[model samples]
Target: MRKLARWHIWLGWLAAVPLLIWLGSGLFMAARPIEEVRGEALRRAAVPMPLSGLVLPREPVVATKLALVDQRGRPTWIVTDADGATGRYSARDGLPLGPVGAAEARELVAAAWNGTAALSALRRFPRDAPPGDLRQSRPSWQATFADGAHLYIDADSGAVLAVRTRWWRAYDLAWGLHIMDLQTREDSSNAFLWLFGTLALAMALLGAALLFRRRRTATGRRA
Candidate 1:
């Protein structure tokens, strides 16, 4: 029993801070509505555009899939090749549309943004260099709005990829801490998490044992 107390005390000192952090972060995450945390209101609803009066590209490319959608109020073809390359072309003339430039990216985000914040800045990320927050390997334009929400636009298709709000980034940071993934913040199966989780469980079990032991001692004394 004495050895158990010593072990519990030592483990308590080691795991207390982490446990509190876990609890606090978890509660902070759970307290808010998931939709708000995800910034669903900031996204513009996608309207389905009919594929009528279309002209396909005759560039002798093997395409795995195709989508005809309205981009900037004009019918466009988004072609997906067998090699996983995606390109946007004009459905009006079947000519390949150029990749989204900085001006077009800013205009796209501003027009599509449902939020009232004014679009502030747009930065282009080339295909060879992708932003860390995007988590996808493709050319993109990151647009910053006045509300501190970042909207990502596909550089090729001029499509809205994602809208990450301030709250969303905060939650992401907390998730990294909770999962114990300091490096990439994507790996939940890290060794550090497993080690600390095991220690926490052991500490809990020892504390339970001590509680039962104290209760049994009290009952014996009364008898």
Candidate 2:
């Protein structure tokens, strides 16, 4: 009984670490609105898309997806063909434009940023390492505002990929610790979390046994 109680106490402490991470992260997520964490509130008001003046290619583009997105402050259509070729067309005359540069990237960030913070950092990632949201759109630009908001823009097409804030970063870190995926901060369905969960359950069962054993001993002494 003594050995079992000692093992239970030690295991409980060990299990508490992961449990606390899960609880703490869950609490933070529940307390904060998800929209704010995603930085949706910091985005600029959407511009009305122009439809009548659109001039598609005379040749069949055979596009898989067509998205009307904001480039700098202008509206543009990004077309992805069936063969995975992407091109940006002007909204007014459908003229193709060159790839996004530093100036256009900064303008895109400024357009999306509704906060009072100025530009703190603006860097480009040339298909090397991307943030969680920009994984699909590699070679992007990350513009960080002084208010702890980050905006990611596609370097190729000048599209705003995603917006992230400091709260999102904290939530991501907590989620990684809770799920035990420190590498990519994804994959919540791994076996490592299951192993720890099983051990924690065993510790709880042993703790219950110890409590019952102590209660019986006290009753016998009173008798």
- In the range 118-174, model 2's lDDT, one tens digit per residue, is 899998887657766454546789998888788887787777778888988887777
Give lDDT for model 1: 0.83
Task: Give the worst 10-residue stretch by lDDT in candidate 2.
Answer: 52-61
Most accurate candidate by TM-score? 1
Residue 217, candidate 1: C-alpha displacement in angstroms: 1.9
TM-score of each: 0.90, 0.81
List candidate 1 segments past 4 Å from native.
Answer: 63-65, 81-84
lDDT of 1 by residue, 68-182 (tens): 7677777778888877678888888898899888777777886678998888888999878887677677889998889988889999888777888888888887888888886
What C-alpha lDDT, on a 0 to 100 scale, does residue 213 get in candidate 1? 100
- The backbone clash count of each candidate, in order, is 0, 1
Superposition TM-score, candidate 2 onto the true structure: 0.81
